[model samples]
Target: MDAIQKSMLEKIADLHEVPEGAYNIRSNGALAGRNTTANIDIVTKQDKPGIDIIIKPGTKNESVHIPVILSESGLNDCVYNDFYIGEGADVVIVAGCGIHNCGTDTSEHDGIHTFFIGKNAKVKYIEKHYGEGDGTGEKILNPTTIVHIDEGGYMEMETTQIKGVDSTIRDTQADLKDGASLVIKEKIMTHGNQTAETNFVVNLDGVDSSANVISRSVAKDSSKQVFNSKICGNNKCYGHTECDAILMDNGHVNAVPSLEANDLDASLIHEAAIGKIAGEQLIKLMTLGLTEHEAEEQIINGFMK
Candidate 1:
């Protein structure tokens, strides 16, 4: 791996070397490396911005990692990744992007990912976005994800952006079939005049289908954030959406959660809360031998986790 790729992997995956049976891609439309097994096929799309990954049928207990890195300044990279999972294939996918820009120019990455999961398949997907540099430049990201789950399929997704991103906008949508389930968890933290906005929509289109959407965020030091989530139920299905945020030091947060049920047997609900950190919790921690700053940091960390 190159110096830039090594640094990015360390920050995002905390890995020294690329793991066995994993795939790697760089932001400059280069295939950094890959180690595939018999159960998975990795193919580069010559006419597209990203690759296509396919999992064989009945393949179980498999894991794949696709990490993207950008080292140059003033660069904008857009990637479109597509995943096709076969029937009864159980897998975990780790995907993330890290940027290092050390010049006075803005760096941005916009990724569009689509997943097609077959019947009875289960997938756990995790994605993270991070930025680092000591320059007067902006690190921006805009991600769009679309998922389709077949009958009896299950998908769980976790996405996080802890720090260093100057701006971000996230959009996610999902469609679930009969006996399918989807769960999405999102976490974000922003500071220093940063801005973030997230929108999610889940459609339960078949009988017994279900979906849950949860979002947690922290904004501090003049930062601003907004979250909007909607769940639509079309059959005898269930859906729930929630958004919670903590704001500090001139931070501003807006949360809007909506639910729509088109069928008489459908059930849908939503909730949202935005507020500052509790004073009593901070005081209790500070009395336990921690300074005010330390207590606040600890609380924020625990809350985001």
Candidate 2:
């Protein structure tokens, strides 16, 4: 890998070198490397342009990384990845994409990921999207994620896209069975006329099922952002969603959050807030020997963190 590509790996996957467990690295529309452990298997799908990740029943404390990188300009790539988590297994899945475009044509990547979690299983999924280059070409990403949780299952998702990406559209949805639960935390930052749109929907479809979705974003320098989320409680369940954002320097942000409750025992709620950074926050940080720009940076960093 080139230094630029390796640098991208560090930012997107937290990998300084080849990881210890199961992993698949894709670069420039092809597979760069792959490995599988005893409890997990990774296989390329014959009918599609992606892979399937399988975690065996009762597997615990293991992880898999599938990170894709693009360096060529005028390239548009798409992939489909499916995950099957076995019953009673507890594991982590790390997946992200990085694009480096240095030409006048657009470089884009679209990934669709689906997860099927078995009964009593617990899974943590982390995904980050990043782009870097000094070219006029746009860096674009569109990611779609779908999740299904069985009875007694739990799933947690942490997704972030905080730098360099010029345009992105992220869509995520989940369905929970009886006694299942889901939690999603999303953070995004856009600058320099960039644009971002995010949509999340979750369904609490069984007794005692629950879901929580939260999004926080910062937009600067005429960038535009949209955060839209909906939670539906169809049975005796609970659902909540929230959206918070900060805008600066002609930036624009719109938040639309909604909820629906169909059953008598179902409870659903939503909240949204969009505003600029507080002057007091900037002042307090600036009093500690920091410039105005530095203070604003610190505040924005803290808010997204």
Candidate 3:
């Protein structure tokens, strides 16, 4: 572990203790400059990494890229060199960031993150956005991820947030080739006077390509959230976009999910719903002796089900 990576690890809680073959790259610098690579089993974290993870076939020439970034712009202005994936490789990638408010007013904190994925590679990417401690509500976190999948490749992307002092916006784009597949699931929970916006776009460029998008969010207190998702298909492809949101007292939610197909041989579907906890179901559970909060929690958990 280098000094910069060690320092970056200090900012994160519950660092996973790595085994012998697991690789860890730590960084406290801007996401553009902290790029690293891995082949077999690897683990890494930093502020942000500008590049993509490329997995190669066979044990000798496995390719990978890791970068950590922290930006003051707060907008989605990020860059990465091209990432390459070998003909056939299997891998798991987790990328995310932890931002410190440091008393900065909200106006200075708007930032966005972007990613690009390669072909014929299998990647499971996990993204986590969180805060260090109590801070002012002026910081904004905007992240955008774009992925391109090749033939016979698979990608799974998921996100989790622990609330923010300010508003947040997240975007995702996945482009898949023939015989490729992408599954995206996003989970978010918010508190305080914060607002969150998320957009998901997937494009199927090859025959037999498939995509699935699922979203779940909870709004509490005086908060707001919006989710927009789109699935595009061509050349006999298959795609689906589904979104559901839950709102609490004084909370607001808006969800728009759409699917567009330009080819007659393509198939697409879109579904979205916005509502609060099911009162009737909660009451029925409470009648069985569960407390109100407990019933609500059970309902929320069941929503994910």
- Specify the highest-lDDT model's number: 2
- Expressed as tens digits, the lDDT of each residue in 76-194 for candidate 1 is 98988899989999999988888888888988889899999999999999999999888788999898999999999999999999688999999999999999999999999999999
TM-score for each predicted model, relative to the true structure? 0.97, 0.98, 0.77
Task: Please rank every candidate by lDDT, starting with the best.
Answer: 2, 1, 3
Superposition-based RMSD of candidate 1 using all C-alpha atoms, in angstroms: 1.2
Candidate 3: list runs displaced more than 4 Å: 1-14, 18-54, 59-83, 102-119, 302-305
Q: Is candidate 2 or candidate 3 better by TM-score?
A: 2
Better of 1 and 3 by TM-score: 1
Query: Distance from true position, residue 51, model 2, in Å?
Result: 0.1
| lDDT, model 1, position 217 | 91
Once superposed on the true structure, which residue ranges of model 2 sit more than 4 Å away at CA? none
Deviation of model 1 at 98, angstroms: 0.5
Q: By the lDDT metric, which is better: model 2 or model 3?
A: 2
Which residue pairs show backbone clashes in model 2?
A: none
Query: Can you write out model 2's per-residue Cα lDDT over 114-230, one digit (the tens) per residue?
Result: 999999999999999999998999999999999999999999999999689999999998999999999999999999999999999888998999998988899999999988888
Q: Candidate 1 at 94: error in angstroms?
A: 0.4
